[model samples]
Target: MDLDHEPATRAHEARLWRDDGWTAKVIKNGDDDGWAVEMTQEGEDEPALVGPWTMGRDKKNPKPLDSAAFITLVKTASEVLRRHEQQRHALLHKNVTIDSGSDRLRIDLDIIPDEYEPYAELSAHNGFGEELARVRVQPGFKLSRESAADWVANNFARPS
Candidate 1:
């Protein structure tokens, strides 16, 4: 079993710190003699944030990890993860409302990004949130005003 996956106990060291499900590690910068710090959430495979670290009073060593610094790093890394999740959600889900006959319909296209066979679900709902129609379409299906209008015009048939 990998130690990284094990339940963590609190640790506070000069170059490494772990607490509150987050770890901050300081490393030598690849491009220069300066140092860089990486912030990773527990059980995650990759660091959510990596940036330049502050130099110590000697200017040749990295600043020691402290309680305040670790707390700030966890906040920043959590925000980065949150933004990434939001962006991905926006990419996979789409919606538009359009006029259909006498009733307004909300059209949604939710993409399922499968590893080998990606697909999408095209669905429609009425103003009262009743399901009108649902069909599977190609993952690359475009869900725009004109495309939605065309679908509604076709009685919710699967788009070619």
Candidate 2:
């Protein structure tokens, strides 16, 4: 593992289930905590997610980055992505709508907690509020962002 390089901008490829995408402009390394990965969609300016990663087995305050840690990070990061997708799918209904003129799509997802009967509704509009989809997820279902991402990537990533 090498910590010599300063925390610069980097990118990493991520694949989860039916979704395959790349995370660009990831911070190389962090100072106080372990390495941090900044993730965002290609066209989206705001970051979709950002998570703190573990350092190598150096037993130091901040472990360096290495091949092994990188692999682990990928696996961990993939799981995060999967969970997000699952949560989105579970929370929302399967209704999708597309607009004609603007070429926009909108998706409505509802997440219900077991404790409460009412579910939280989240509406995500792409391009415009034209393409709309909705899904109803189990309120009791637990959401593990990391595990879900890993499962999808390992089991459902597109070949090659």
**What's the distance in Å from true for residue 109, model 1?**
0.7
Looking at model 2, residue 105 earns an lDDT score of 41
The parts of candidate 1 lying over 4 Å away from their true place are 1-5
Residue 61 displacement in candidate 1 (angstroms):
0.9
> Which segments of candidate 2 are over 4 A away from where they belong?
1-49, 53-62, 94-160
Candidate 1 TM-score, C-alpha based:
0.94
In candidate 2, how many clashes are counted? 26
Give the TM-score (vs. native) of candidate 2: 0.30
Residue 118 in candidate 1, Cα distance off native in Å: 0.4
Query: Which tens-of-lDDT digit does each residue in 117-143 have in candidate 2?
Result: 765443335574542333334443333
> Cα lDDT of model 1 overall?
0.94
